[model samples]
Target: MYIRKKKNTSGSISIQIIKKIKGKSKVIESIGCSKDPDKIERLLKKAHKRIKELEPTLFDSVKQEEQKLKFLPISNEQVIPIGDELFFGAIFDRIFNKKTIFQSVYKANDKHELFKALVISRILYPGSKLYLSDYLFYFKKKEISDEAIYRLVDSLYKDEVKQRIEEAVYKDTLAKVGGKIAVCFYDVTTLFFESESEDDLRRIGFSKEGKLARPQIQLGLFTTLQGYPLSYEVYHGKKYEGHTLLEALLNFQKKFKLKNKPIVVADRGMLNDANIAFLENNGYKYILGAKIKMLPSGIKDKIINLTFIDDNVTHEINIHKTITYKQDKQKHSLDISQRLILTYSSQRAKKDKYLREKALDKLKAKIEYSTNLTKNDLKLSHYAKYLDIVDDCKVEFRLNHNKVLQDSKLDGLKGYLTNDTTLSHKDIIEHYQNLWHIEKAFRISKTDLQIRPIHHRLEHRIKAHILISFVAYAIYKEFEIKTREIKKEYQISYKILRDLIKHVFAIKFDDGEIFPIKLSEVQQKFYDALHS
Candidate 1:
């Protein structure tokens, strides 16, 4: 076997171990590929070492076997447990230590180590604080007491740790996206607790997960267009989702002191007169999802009557109105002009029609099966608007054909409200569509990082928990981006990558020397991508 440096079309060098048989060279193994001179030298050294290991001599093999037998016996008691100290732990350390601002925020050695452990554990194996010590000891062989963990959590809540981290993320993300943010996305979700009792911070409110009886906290997150989180705030559980927009945006602007105002894009849940007026009054531009059904009668009629030549076509309407809202029990009014963009999609229309038909079928089935219909029945059904009741000592129900026809007329239609006239209607619609990135961020936090069902009772600890999850998510997103950029040919999902990390472990001998086991082709690709 021989080491060969092959040049590629991209001006990079690939170091591989090759063998010659009958004048044809066969690649035995690929060490690595890189364009940097220092990395190439390193790869060359690795190639030499790999060659020696792969082509061991007879005496070297016997010696190695003897050494293994001497050190590790074939008995269960004598076997040392392999821990995941190489791949999973090392990748996290490399990413966290190099890419994140936590190193600057956390100075003390114990605090830094504990914080690292907490974040890593939260990403790999999310659990309660009591199990963290055990998890570390088993998986990483690092010992950290529960007391130390709680103490770090307490300290994190103080000293403006959360704010500092936010600043760090903002600067990092700002540098990432060409040092400017033209558009941003905002969304809120509920994180419920497992407990029944309510505290000042965690109270019974509208649960997005349908756990209305359980206490929860509202999390408002601001992310870049690509879904990299910038800032977040935890609000009172019962706070109105619409009311959070102004507070969160103002705080984000004040903290970051941004020179350029980024256009905010949100869903219909954040659509309100006060928010629209606030966005316009604060010198900020926005693209908000418009409530087409609630628009003025004239505007609604115009939107409904518009014709679409194709699914990609959109119509724009200029709206001028005065918005009045009460603040501090005083009435205030603001006049604003905005553009409403309406678009049609065949796919959306099909889904909408399917849902409407399904609801009507269910409603009709309920009315047909029941002997007597009460007011409560109609009150609970969302399709109640399409039904009318006549009471004369007995209740008779009739489907409102007019309302059904009106609703069908608006099918396949969607609206977006924007104040930025320079942008095309298509651009506004596209910006609003990117709002799903924030939704995906929330999903990652809740499902992958297990940000909900918080176990901590103390408010500070709860905040600290969220901060840790936020940091973990940042790292996770970085890893995801790197994976895509580095390995364009093969894509790895986070779930599968997580599983591979969990299984990629290392064995430590009695002499305190650790060696990672051989990795499969896929795992090697992931490892290389991570390192790259």
Candidate 2:
């Protein structure tokens, strides 16, 4: 039988052809037809009672082969080229292409050695210099030798690199933030060397980290509170921290013309009569830490007589006030001072104990093991004298047993010697606290950026390396600022942005086909946002 209705143009019809035994109906076979009904009826007639023929049909399979063979036109919007703004090891593809920034750096310095130093920071990277040749350029396609790299790295000094970086930062920052309250900060650290050559620049000096008996180089750093570097200088191996202060301040004044005297802030290491005198005579204001030991006996008596008052209501703070005096033996005069404030905290004392124990442990271990002694051993009585603490111990376990247990606590009372007596004690303490950020910046430089042990024997190269570090630091600070400045609605953090960028993948096609190799959703959005 044939039946026809409103021939479904918008839909499809399916017919089944099956075979069955006599009176015993079973779906032995069924053929489904979604295409032509005429063909389905013809197929059903061919089916017999004993045998079965099942045929299946549909509109069509997907046009996959056609898709595989035919090329799709790629629009300009479809192509995403990798831009060059890479930083912190190309981990970040920043707004400014790193190639452009690098070229800018190169232009500012305009020296092959300085360029090589920056590149070394990228390639040499701690371990085996395996990919050194890949980065080399060929004037006539000749491969440069590893000897060339050694010469470049060896010849590079800290001063040349530092000068270029300083100039670059000044130019770039001034162009951007121009004549801001760029609070320049000063601090010093010591780097000890393994070599024993008493060269003019490298001498056995007092290490700020108290690396006594180890020949060291004293480095005084002047940087803005924002981590923008202003100037840096290396002093005699044994120059006192106090001694570098006047020079550093003088250097800052000479290098960067301060139309208005900059308020220089320093820690206890910079407190001295000469430094104070210079600050006053030069029309400079300073916030310096006071040395409790430097105060006279009369001051000590006055400080003990000082009184304390509670200030927990208004500012949730405690107040203590005392009067102190300093006696200059050389001048034969007493400098009567006022306002010695003492605040007590158990937590602070505990922290002091912890750090002192840590430093004492390290120092004691070094002093106990005196092998291959250097000539500078005589000048290290501060820590070297501690060696007698382990005198009874034998060769075995000397580093552990005799030295490790010696306990010492840092000085509890710290005094601030500031010419500006008008500042409330709390304000003075808060300002001094800002010094930690600078110290932290130095720590990050030494640990994260690996700024230690002058690899270049040349004094200038040493200076240049430090200068380059200053630039890196400034850039790092800018990165941090930009990340923080991003609107909360964007919800893009530096770490998250970094993660998104890592998701972006580079695809290379042998047949010149353009496609996404791999990209996360957020990364794609970020890429799109940049383009937008």
lDDT string for model 1 (271-329, tens) is 98888877887899999888887787798889888998779898999999999987678
Predictions in order: lDDT: 0.80, 0.52
Report per-prediction Cα RMSD to one decimal. Answer: 8.9, 14.2
Model 2 Cα lDDT, one tens digit per residue, 80-185: 4332123232322231233423343434333343343354342223112223353232111235566655544444444443344455555555444566643456
Superpose all Cα atoms of candidate 2 onto the true structure and report the RMSD in Å to 1 decimal: 14.2
Task: Kindly give the stretch of ten consecutive residues in candidate 2 with the minimal lDDT sum.
Answer: 310-319
> After superposing candidate 2, which stretches have Cα over 4 Å from the reference?
1-84, 88-164, 171-178, 209-213, 309-342, 349-413, 484-532
TM-score: model 2 vs. ground truth: 0.57
TM per candidate: 0.78, 0.57
